[model samples]
Target: MHYCQSCETPVAMEPRNGHAVCPECGRADDVAAPGPLFVVTGASGSGKTAVLAGLARRLQGRCVTFDADLLMDAAGALSGSRPIDWPAFRDAWLAVAHGVAQSGMPTVLLGPFIPTHLQELPARRWIGDIHFIVLDCPDELRRARINARPPWRSRDIEEQVEFGQWLRRNIADRVDTSSELQKTPRRPSPHGSTAI
Candidate 1:
């Protein structure tokens, strides 16, 4: 939250054009042009986390990359005692991405986000168009990878495989991570003004 200098009102800062202005006072804060959001989505064990690690390094100063899992701990806060409100959780990540865009860096979020998880959100207005890239691998490989993980992760292989197929059918961009496992993360599919 930003404070309006003249009126001392708390401002929920969101970029307009290329700047964020205090609605109370109309005093503008210089914010960089908003950048499009890039979402690298996949089912569990589809190499999203591994890919994010590489992207954070490779994208260094060019753009910012993040794992949506970083906010998992705060899910309780967002949802209270009820089951996690997934849409609210997604909104938080979108807000973070929009804030980063104000600093002139495009953001790539790594997670299990489908288009519906983002496209209709209120926060979507603060960022540019969203582009989704699904990371994919053979079903056998995906199962083996999830099973190899520590016991805490869900090992429901069939469910994940089904989800992966849905993503492939609905999203046009896909990175066959099994083929690229030895390589660094594949570059994300391009979108409206983002350099990634």
Candidate 2:
């Protein structure tokens, strides 16, 4: 039997409307399909890139990193010389990520975004339940990691650290990356239900 890609609840042979409704949360799993998308957002040097890289390697899937900056570049006019459009950038990020999830591959998105980016998406798109993994840690430690990175790495660790802290405070259920926190969540139940 087929199943909901997001939560794994069994689905009828002909699931309605190309959408998979999760029997557990009453939430639509993925409107399109499953790609095991994991979004890891954090200030630079929060170890998100490293952690996601490790996860990608371990999973044996080609790690795809979708930086919204690319979208900004695609729309250089709106993105401007600074590459900062919080609202538009966030919208684009959610769209690309949701599509990636539908592609049925493993994906890891690293960015600096607030929780509302996902929380505010339209539920009908069934864009909800995209695994959000926030990377957080003491600002100082994060700063150190950033400084240790190659010259190409971000140098404004303080600003990013501030943002990360703000997100960590505002968002509920962020797995702390300060130390060695597990990245992957336990698998959902057979019927596509989350215990939480």
Candidate 3:
């Protein structure tokens, strides 16, 4: 599930001369075997970055752990007031995760993503089951966490609070991040299936 950066269109798995070329922009890249995609999502300051750091340490040799935001620079320009194509950004990440999974290691991606963002994308077929784990904490605590971040990382407090509330209400698989992240239980097996 690749997205053509030039055309801003979803790229499907079709080969031309044994190479996967974007029908929309003629962009080319290699396609790899598919594997499950696990998304660790939450609002800003929900400890996603922290949790990813810990999870990466634990799952280092077992699976691939990545911060989805690392691709922000490649996804699109963020200097102006132009509206970002969030879905396209998400699809691009999915494609990357799929590529990484070809090594037989499932990818655990951390970002402000929800199941709705990736479940229905054409790239969804590139992976096996998609699992979503929402990280949440109380609104007041979340505000404090966000407030403590560096000025460059600051976000709209109200918006993040609302987004956190919405995730708790909609997602069943959640990790209460108000407490120490180390206290969080062991994650699902990273081999192929995620119990959560």
lDDT of 1 at 68: 81
lDDT of 3 by residue, 78-159 (tens): 5245655777777777777777776778989888887878887766667777888899999998887767655555468898
In terms of lDDT, which candidate is stronger, 1 or 3?
1
Candidate 3, which ten residues in sequence have the lowest lDDT sum? 187-196
lDDT to native, each model = 0.76, 0.56, 0.73
Q: Candidate 1, which segments miss by more than 4 Å at Cα?
A: 1-16, 20-32, 182-196
Which ten contiguous residues of candidate 1 have the minimum total lDDT?
Answer: 187-196
Give the 10-residue window scoring lowest on summed lDDT in candidate 2.
Answer: 187-196
After superposing candidate 3 on the true structure, give the runs of residues whose Cα lies further than 4 Å from its correct spot: 1-32, 78-82, 181-196
Q: For this target, which candidate reaches the highest TM-score against the unseen true structure?
A: 1
lDDT of 2 by residue, 129-158 (tens): 456667778877777666655553347766
For each candidate, how many residue pairs have backbone atoms clashing (under 3 Å)? 0, 4, 0
lDDT of 1 at 176: 90
Which candidate number would show the highest lDDT if scored against the true structure? 1
Candidate 1 vs candidate 3: the TM-score winner is 1
TM-score of each: 0.79, 0.55, 0.73
